[model samples]
Target: MLGLFIAQVLNGLLDGTYYLLIALGLSLIFSLGGIINLAHGAFFAIGAYLALLITPYVGYFGALVAVPLIVAGLGMVTERTLFTRFYRIDPLYSLLLTFGIAMVIEQGLRWVFGASPQSYNIPDILRGQVFLGDFIYSRYRIFLIAVAAVAVAGLWLLLNRTSFGRIVRAGVQSPEIVGALGISLRPYLSIVAGIGIGLAGLAGVLLSPIYTIHPAMGAEIITLAFVVVVIGGLGSFWGVIIAAVLVGLTKGVLVAIGLSSWSTAAIFLLMFVVLLLRPRGLLGERILRFE
Candidate 1:
């Protein structure tokens, strides 16, 4: 029983990685663009569908590499065509826009692929279990953790270490100052959107094998992803990471205690506690635009 409890805790942590991937992108896009992208999950679904379509020709590894880039390109296009128009306007406009896009993508997928769920097999190379003492875990999940960690670390370095990141951070604080410095945030905005949305695509690819792939899969996950972002605070990168872990831990503990049916409710309860304590989120920093 103790072993099972420990295993459930670990499983919960693994579950957090999925939210981490999706929520990071949600946070980044909102931080930089001021766009509350409701359609981000649709992109995630697209990635999974794209993986299914391409994996046959390029294989799983190939799909993993190619799908994100393709989705990122699509994100860049969306930023240029749709997001750019609403940057200086009311945020609600962008929200509505993204919601419509989400619906379109969902229905488009349904039209093309039907409403049925699709299945993806685990790659042959990653198929197995690893036993650690009395606990056993999926090898693919281990690989998923490693990939998510690397992606997070790389993103951190890019934001904290690079000149591009410096500008983005400054822009987040004060777009007026960035504009005064004669830096057109246009290119940066496009790139950020691509990077953020691309991460969603990557999550879709990595999770497709384990999750049921369907048109509404994106919709199903987006709410939890939003919960993570809200609990973490809107623009705080580290907050999102911590929140994801906490959310996962909360769910894990609930399951371990034999309240598995209440796991989802427990996460919301955890968020309520966090918000009651810290309205701005655990580490949410004040930004000019949001204020």
Candidate 2:
């Protein structure tokens, strides 16, 4: 039972890491772009599909490094051509546009790759398991934890320790002020979109090995990602992290207790509770919009 408990906790922590990656990007995009990108999941699907196509040529590590850039470039293009138009309009327009984009991407991928799910094998190096006393865990999972931790730390540094990051955060708070200060926030907005989409791509790459790659995969996880965002608050960075961990751990514990069926529902329930108690989210700041 102790071993089982330990294993569940480990699994929960890893699941939280996945949520963190997805939610972080969602938070960044919504906070900075002021648009709820319903197509964010499409970027995720693109990353996994791109990995499947390129991994054979460049290897897993190469695909990991390359796919995010490719996706980011695509994100920048989409932002400039399509998303930028709706920023000044009602956010509803952008939301609808993104929803359409998501549908298009999903259908396009399905047409190209067919409806069957694809699988990728973990690299030989990351295979096998490690023992911690009597508990054993997959090395790949440990690598996931490491990768997620590093990504989070790097993001924190970028946001808190760097000038560019400061500008982006400031832009999030006041775009007009940023522009008035002789800084063109337009470029930063594009970069923020690219970075946000790139993070989603990264999540897809990491998840490809564990989950089956399918067009619908992104749709499946995207709602949960939104739940994480709402629980964490719309624009709160640390809030997403905390909510993700809490949801992940709670789901893991529920599954361990033989209530696997209720894991997702448990997440929704938690979100509802958070909403009732703290409507602004755990770490969310003042209401940004007049909804």
Candidate 3:
């Protein structure tokens, strides 16, 4: 039982990475753009589908590098063409617009990819299981964990240690100040949109082999990602990270105890409790008002 518990916990941690990546993007976009993006999941689905189409030509390694770029570019275009116009308008308009886009993308993918789930071939090198102490886990899962950690670490360094990151952080706080300083917030905000959407794409690519790749795959995870964002605090970077791990572990523990069906309910319950206890979220700082 102890070994099983440990194994499940590890599995939960692996699952947390997906939540982290998705929420990271959601949080970043909201922080920088003041636009609540409901179509973020569509970007994820697009990434997975793109990977499916491109992987044969480029192979898994090449697809990994190309898919995010493709999705990020798409996101940038969407921002430039659609989202940017809605920024100073009501947040509801942005939300409704993105929601519509998500539906359109989802239905389009369904028409193209069909209603069924597609199988993603796990690379031969990552197919086996490895023993970690007394518990054995899939090597692919461990690789996913490593990739998520690295991605999160890289993002942290980018936001904390670099000039662009500083601009992002400052812009998140006050775009007016950033503009007054002579830096056009447009490029930085666009980049944030790309990074945010790209992170979702990256998550889609990483989890494709493990989960059933389908047109509605983004819908499956987006709610949980939003829950992570709310529980972690809307624009709080570290808050999202902590909430992702917490929610993932909670679900893992329930599943390990033979309550898999209750996992989602449990997470929602936890979110409710957290909101009641700390409305701003675990690591959320003062909410920023975008001008």
lDDT of model 1 at residue 177?
A: 86
Work out candidate 2's RMSD over C-alphas. 1.3
TM-score of each model, in listed order: 0.98, 0.96, 0.97
RMSD in Å for all candidates? 0.9, 1.3, 1.4
In candidate 3, residue 31 scores what lDDT? 88
Q: Let me know the TM-score candidate 2 reaches against the reference structure.
A: 0.96
Write the residue-wise lDDT of candidate 3 on 1-291 in tens digits: 888998899878767878899899999999888888889998999999999999999999898889999999999999999989998988999999999999999999999989999989889988999987888888998888888899899999999999999999888888889899999999888999999999989988888998888989888989999999989998898899989999989999999999999999999999999989988888777755842
- lDDT at position 136, candidate 3: 83
**Candidate 1: C-alpha lDDT:** 0.93
Per-model CA lDDT versus the true structure: 0.93, 0.89, 0.90
For residue 191, give model 2's deviation from the true position in Å: 0.4
lDDT of 1 by residue, 71-183 (tens): 99999999999999999899999999999999999999999999999989999999999999888889998998898899999999999999999999998888888999899
Best by lDDT: 1
Clashing pairs in 3: none
